[model samples]
Target: MGSGVGMGMGWMWLFWVLLILGVVLLAVVAVRAFGGGVTRSDRGDGRMSQERSRARQVLDERYARGEITTEEYRERLSALGEDR
Candidate 1:
């Protein structure tokens, strides 16, 4: 009787584990179906935008510090297409 109860409980645990896994799998599929994930191209565009902003910030800082002359700053900004 004791051995039978243990075997039954083991199967019960397995059933619960599989149920949980199925729920998780379903959620993942739903999210993908709903377009809730970022695509590679989207990520690349965001990264490029960030890099451009960082470069602009560095240029601004250098100009403020007199590390670059106004003419040089304007030239660099134009080269970066960031003239403003």
Candidate 2:
């Protein structure tokens, strides 16, 4: 009968350990969700910006050379959001 006391104590310890582990896991998840541990290197070095600028430049050059219709240039530029 006395052995049951140790069983409850062991369960209590296990519950506390699990609670602590859960808290730590939630904190890690929150940090990752908020981009706390990520860095500029993970984003590929302004790659999107470079691509957009290059596309805009090409559009401008093509428009200058009258190679593409104004409507086509405007539509593509707007799609890329590089018309600004």
Write down the TM-score of every candidate.
0.48, 0.46
Superposed on all Cα atoms, the candidates' RMSDs to the truth, in angstroms, are: 6.2, 6.8
The sequence of per-residue lDDT tens digits that candidate 1 reaches over residues 1-84 is: 455656677589889999999999999999988976777636855887788889999999999999999999999999999878
lDDT, each prediction? 0.88, 0.84
Which 10 consecutive positions of candidate 1 have the poorest summed lDDT?
1-10
Q: Report, for all candidates in order, the number of backbone clashes.
A: 0, 0
Residue-wise C-alpha lDDT for candidate 2, range 6-31, written one tens digit per residue: 67775798899999999999999998
Question: What would the C-alpha RMSD of candidate 2 be, to one decimal place?
Answer: 6.8
Candidate 2, run of 10 with poorest lDDT: 35-44
Error of 2 at 6 (Å): 41
